[model samples]
Target chain A: QIAVANAQELLQRMTDKCFRKCIGKPGGSLDNSEQKCIAMCMDRYMDAWNTVSRAYNSRLQRERANM
Target chain B: MDPSASGMGSVDPRLRHFIEVETQKQRFQQLVHQMTELCWEKCVDKPGPKLDSRAEACLVNCVERFIDTSRFIVKRLEQTQKSKAGFSESLSD
Candidate 1:
């Protein structure tokens, strides 16, 4: 249940962001080129998310050590 | 007591532990989602074939600096409140 909810949230956010990043103008349909861009965009977004999570987690660990 | 946590009579000890761990993990994931969107604008110009080294470094730095800035602001606020309290105490005396 938790995993499903998390995936759904990620999907919703990725769709919103990738659409904005990849789709320049409203087209008749999501064309081949547009589809390609969205795929790459999703991959990069997940990369960014992991980088941030790791950085934040290390920062929290460092702060805890100081205390 | 939280209504959500009220029904604990039948909840298994292992399931309770799982719930606690999952809640913490979800919080981390949610923040990652938020920060990714926030930093994507700053770090990424366009989605490329892969996340280039430069953009990856930028995202990492952005996350660290963001947390640093948050801690700095909170410390500053506490200092301000401490000074104000001291000033008011002196006035009362």
Candidate 2:
């Protein structure tokens, strides 16, 4: 249940971010180029999330070891 | 009324520990979401075929610098608070 909620939150943020990045100006409908941009944005967002997570985790570990 | 029997003390220690760990994990996930949004803007110009090496490096540095900024703010605030307390103490004396 916790995992599900976490995933949902991630999905919500990703959608928000991708929409902002891909849609410069909302057209009549979702254009092919916009769709492609969103797809790429989603992938990059996930990659960024993973990178931040790893960075934070290692920092915590280093701080703990220092303590 | 026995407080231990009525409240959190009644829960098993292992369960309590599990809850604490889960809460910590949730906080970690929350921060990751926030940092991703922040760093995405700073590091990512446009979504590309992949996260290029330069963008990847920027994200990593962004995370490090963000944490450093947080720590610096906290330390600065503590220093100010300490000085304020000392100022008040001296005034009182």
Candidate 3:
């Protein structure tokens, strides 16, 4: 379905961006340390995305309630 | 758009509207990703064992204030333009 494709595309973009942010150079087969760092980075990135989304949503809700 | 939509050669208004909203949400999500990345470099010292409450709070406040700052600039610019235009109109009379 289109939704699935959209998700895959977004996931791909997210991974690429995060990988570039976390990985400096292509080391020997993605060493354990690199893998761990990437894993953690991905989680933190998702956390950041969620926090922003929640904050923005609540702000919109507050504005709507006020208006 | 949906493959079905392509096959049908037409997209329903309701589906189109849904897609529009989803697109807007995706843009918001993408900006959040970008901001988080930028702020992480500034506010995050290290990849903790987990994101501490303090770090999470920093991100939330960063997002809120970032938005506030954007709106503030926009409104200020609008007011500036309004005053500038008012001055020009009065002087030209």
Cα TM-score per model: 0.78, 0.86, 0.69
Judge candidate 2 at residue B4 and give its lDDT. 50
Candidate 2 chain B has its poorest 10 consecutive residues by lDDT at B83-92
Poorest lDDT segment (10 consecutive residues) of candidate 1 chain B:
B83-92
Judge the docking of candidate 2 as incorrect, acceptable, medium or high: high
lDDT tens per residue, model 1, A1-67: 8778878888899899999888999889999999999999999988887788788899889988999
Q: How do the residues A1-67 of candidate 3 rate in per-residue lDDT, one tens digit apiece?
A: 4557545655775587668766887876887887888788777766666676788788879988999
DockQ of 2: 0.86
Clashes of 3: 0
lDDT of 1 by residue, B1-93 (tens): 867677865799899998889989888778777888889989987989999999999998999888778889999977987867875467669
lDDT per residue as tens, model 2, A19-64: 8888998999999999999999999999998999999899989999
lDDT of 2 by residue, B1-93 (tens): 878557877799999889889989999888888998899999998888999999999999999999999999999977986867875466669
lDDT of 2 at B26: 92
TM-score of chain A of 2: 0.90
Best by lDDT: 2
- Identify the runs in model 1 with alpha carbons over 4 angstroms from their true place: B1-20, B85-93
